[model samples]
Target: MINWFDIRDYGAVGDGTCIDSPAINRAIQAAAAAGGGAVCVPAGIWLCFSIRLASHVRLHLDAGAIIRAAVPGAMGAYDLPEPNPHNMYQDFGHSHWHNSLIWGEGLTDIAITGPGMIDGHGLTSKGPGAKWAKRKGYFPESMAGMSAAELAAEDPEEAAMQGQGNKAVALKNCTQVTLSDFTLAKGGHFAVLATGVDHLTISRLRIDTDRDGLDLDCVRHCVVSHCRINTPNDDAIVLKSSLALGQVRPTAHVRIHDCHVSGFDPGSMLDGTFRRTQDKAPDQDGMTGRIKLGTESNGGFHDIEITSCTFERSRGLALETVDGGMLTDIRVSDITMREITTAALFIYAGARMRAPEGTPPGGIRGVRIERVRATDVDPRFASIIAGQVGTPVRDVVLSDIDITYRGGLAALNVPVPEKPDAYPEPSMFGPLPAWGLFIRHAAGLRVQGATLSTTQADGRPALWLDDVEAVHFEQVDLNNAAATPPLVCRDVRGLTGEMVP
Candidate 1:
């Protein structure tokens, strides 16, 4: 009924010493040539450089099978990155698919389903910023006149990844893809980078990685479920709509549910260690493993739902559409979080405008987040909703939110900046003026059934509003640390609320 091609039948030696990617690719090609079938990778340590995938092929890895990615230029090297003149729009990793341990582009009906492990020990990965600026012809003023060798010595990982692959799995412009039931360990830069894909389903994946767990960029009609992702360095499951495909393709109609995101040390989740050994990420911030949307908002996000997720020792849920991408019709519910480094909930819409020229700044509207419970969260940025001066965030709702902040701040009237073109991080604004809720440059925001408390007493007001209109609060209880002035308002219009101190 169906064709099956085993790697062993195609001269594959899974001895850990031999480079078996060529043989694995042969089996995939054979399965593809046979009009669609499964390529079997049985139980063994199949050391590889890069294993390319094809259309209509299902790469099935049996239990105990391990596809370990060797260091580039150690045994063999991965495919060279394809040329992209539009790479300056996004990071270098998001622009290329070929330079990855497993990659596919412009195909259909492909899947990678199994319980096997992908060990990415030797791969190198680095995110955007000045470290990757050289790739995009951007050198900061800090490195004024450093020699090439000195630059290489400064950031050795960048030098090591030159002409090498850094991703675990990368797919681009494909349709009808499925990835499930896999254990991904130490995924280099990104465990999975799926850009411009449609009808994608990722489920039951346990990813404990060095960097970002999943980067879904400009994808459409996708569903991610039952995954446990741990990334102490970067985001766990981030939905981005970047200008990678040289077009404005909004990531729409996505549903993510029943997932667990954490900030445990790399490889500790699989080993059951769950250690907090690693202190800070490359950005010198606390562990950043959370489900987020956008810092790359070239294309907008529409009609997205995230429910039944848990966050452990990580950042909280964030909605950031800085780079000129509209965020609308999004609903998040039933989330539980602990040990949050940033805000329990952060929403931002700014005017970074990193897209092509003449692109207008985007705004956020019609968002509903409810049934969220967070504890031991940092009070420096407690639940922020902010927008630019001219472009205000609109029509958002936060319901049934119970948050306990680990508060210890003694400042009032903290001057906030209007960093319209700055990066959109929860802590971008240093030490929010409010201790519980900070709302600015927004309209039509409703907060109902919210119970806010703090472990330590805070000096600021429980609720602070600035430049907002039509804001209504019902059944709000600021329990222990509701300041002397429970509510503070500045330039607020049409505010109606009953705040219980």
Candidate 2:
């Protein structure tokens, strides 16, 4: 029998109104005092402020147990965010660790398991730029005097996150952790924010959140498997290498597989409703939940593998290292996407050196993606592989891919700008000139056995290349547009390919 340290034995009343973090902390302390054991949080509504974690402790929540984050007020408040001098390099939410519902720093051999729920309904999720998804493009006049049709933007107001616990579970500088078999609802800014942690395994969790589902930054030797993440507002599962730990720590040797990422209506996944409520464009409010890497690539990424994942009602896969990080040796395969909103695949390398002022531009090399099948994808943006003028993305291979685009858009005559310092997004350069694939500033690219098709008879070329070097294709079926060329090449060198209609 497991000698569980029950929280109820330590003056924890499992009522919804009472603040139970002190009792829970006492239970954890007692478990640590006894040289580590399981801590039992039985079934009830346990309202808490901040629950700190210790080493070698497994918090097992029973069935129907709910650890709801308490509202910050006279009743109680969470721990204040410790000052981070390196806070200027990243967003405000990514800098702090202690201002969370459950936080741990510098611990070892910890686990948070069991089939319970963490409902962060009262946590602070006040998005400043736009309102919720209801008014997709409507902006109030109070939003800096901009009207509804302008599509205005605003910088994040950091002072607005005053005393609000924005993350459900936050860990920093820890090791040998496992989080499994739980349900997270309404996670405020990020459901789980893990940085500088190693040997972490996150599996079999259902996360339906408002913003990012899992933000793994500066982590090493991690495996994320068998998780279903739904985030309608931001990224679902992202790997970043921010300068959050006050140093350059690379995220390496990561493997993610057997996961399902989506962008559905909030609270629909948990309630089993599974509704697709947002009807606007992908950039508006509801459809950005895709697997990605970096907008904070300070330390770089290496030896990452992603396989056997499904995407639905979401944006397509993206790989980015714009903040001066080397993204290399990425292998992704066996992916299927349906109802994709934007580009089916996007790879970019830029000179956004968001690190300490002198960081150089990053490189992307040795990426192989195979057996990807996407259907009913957006037509405005194509799968793009782009780099800057001198530093081009190198050595990419795409094989055995099939994609179907909803392609009613007419090709417009416009020059695609190389936004070297802009945010790395698939839709960064508006409507692309091609309907299938667009390549720019790349080297040593090989495409084999691709079947690109469109539903609505697009007017753009199937393949467009510019300023690229050493391109090769084999057994690729290009679109047969009437009186339009199947391929458009400019400033390209050493092109050797067999293309068929």
Q: Each prediction's TM-score against the native? A: 0.94, 0.94
True-structure RMSD, every candidate: 3.2, 4.3
TM-score of predicted structure 1: 0.94
* Cα displacement (Å) at residue 470, model 1: 0.5
- What C-alpha lDDT does candidate 2 achieve relative to the native structure? 0.85
**Superposition-based RMSD of candidate 1 using all C-alpha atoms, in angstroms:** 3.2
Compose the digit string of candidate 1's lDDT tens values, residues 126-225: 6433322323223322243567775554345433455576799999999999999989988878899999999999999999998899999999999999
List, residue by residue over 49-79, the lDDT tens digit for candidate 2.
9899999998888898999999999997888
Off by over 4 Å in 1: 127-162, 481-483
Candidate 2 lands at a TM-score of 0.94
lDDT of each: 0.86, 0.85
Instruction: Please tell me which predicted candidate would have the highest lDDT against the true structure.
Output: 1
